[model samples]
Target: MRLIVKIMLLFPVLLYSQSNFEKAEKLFSQEKYALAKPIFENVIKENPNHLKALEYLGDIEGMNKSWDSAMFYYGKLKQLNPKEANYYYKYGGCLGMKAKDCNKFKALGMISDIKSSFEKAIQLNPNHIEARWALIELYLQLPGIVGGSERKAQKYANELLKISPVDGYLAKGHIAEYFERYKDAEKNYTKAIAIGGSKTTYQKLADLYKNKMNQPQRAKLVLETYQDKTKS
Candidate 1:
């Protein structure tokens, strides 16, 4: 009889938590993060292992650019669900953002952890496109003295091609630009434009024309075209 009474008492609390979570989720969906955060915090307070609340908190913190707080929530999520690729990816991304603003020594110390997190995310889910892209950029931007490798970047670009041709071309274009292969960069960027010309691709092309090719006239034309396209 006592156990039955305890079960009855617990049911209402569970229902209340579910209701609050649903309300918080609705707020979050509407991008009312400031309002939703406290509700999620309340839910987490009531149920420390509320996975959805934890994930949402991490996302909210990340969107707000509170990297350390985002990392804390994502790190908790990672501990709770280590097998989730998204958790590791977000965690690594938060770490990367934090490293960018930190001191050089601290940033250097974070490099291996950032790399491993992204690599682990990919290992867990090979089709994780964002993780692959992050890995590619990490390889491209880092010096060869560290773990950076143009060959690795190329390899990942090829992999991205298998997943998304447009992204692959963009990655190749970026790598080419990085190495001052202006002609190759222009070619790849052009290919990306031909495939699916986004505003970003147009901007990239315009920047290349202005900065690399010394063709301000062509860059201005490109920008004018972009404005025309976007306005319509």
Candidate 2:
């Protein structure tokens, strides 16, 4: 997700493409996402090789949660510039969405595709932290019989810890949730929340405590916190 955000920020690079690009950038800066989209599309049609436009197109799709479209643009941008970490990272994101949307019968194939995309991204750039996180998330969500392993999750958690120790706690919390270790999950999540937390983190903790852990009071507290943040 951070990779997606980085790509989104890079979209402003197109502001250097003569005056039209600047116009689009102004619209974007003004939070006119829909208004800015067409101009960016026009830029792409004018110069398909425009890296910024392609990257931004992917970002726009990502912003809208159009996973399929995001994947398409990211794939094109990756071909044009295979070395950039974010392109590969966003591509992995697209695959992750596909995995989530796939039916149970198709889940295995989707997971394979998602894993492949992330592996490629990491291969191209090992420093792509989001790509690694994507892989870890998939690993935790997927089943063990098919390449998903608690062992691998722990490995990635360790790798992530090397980068940000606090975020490592969040990652481990996710792993605990996956393995059905509810108490451990809550503990890890509480640690993560004690640091700066996001809605995703809050929701996970709430769900685990509410449904899985049968600790409704704790869930309500976290949900209250989430609602407060959303309101403010």
Off by over 4 Å in 2: 1-17, 29-31, 103-107, 193-232
Q: Could you tell me how far off, in angstroms, the CA of residue 137 lies in candidate 2 after the best superposition?
A: 2.1
Candidate number with greatest lDDT: 1
Residues 119-216, candidate 1, lDDT per residue (tens digit)? 89988998888998898888887778887899999998888888888888888998999899999999988888888779888889899999998999
Single out the weakest 10-residue window by summed lDDT for candidate 1: 138-147
Quote the positional error of residue 93 for candidate 1 in Å.
0.9
For all predicted structures, in order, the TM-scores are: 0.87, 0.73
Per-residue alpha-carbon lDDT of candidate 2 for residues 1-232, written as tens digits (9 for 90 to 100): 9999998886775554546666877888787879888988888766679888777778778888898899999999888988877787788787777667778777677776677777787788765677778878777776777877778878878887777665677788878877788789888888777775777778878988888988999889998988888898
Q: Which ten residues in a row have the lowest lDDT in candidate 2?
A: 13-22
Q: Rate the local accuracy (lDDT) of all candidates.
A: 0.92, 0.79
Itemize residue pairs with steric clashes in candidate 2. none
Backbone clashes in each candidate structure, one number apiece?
0, 0
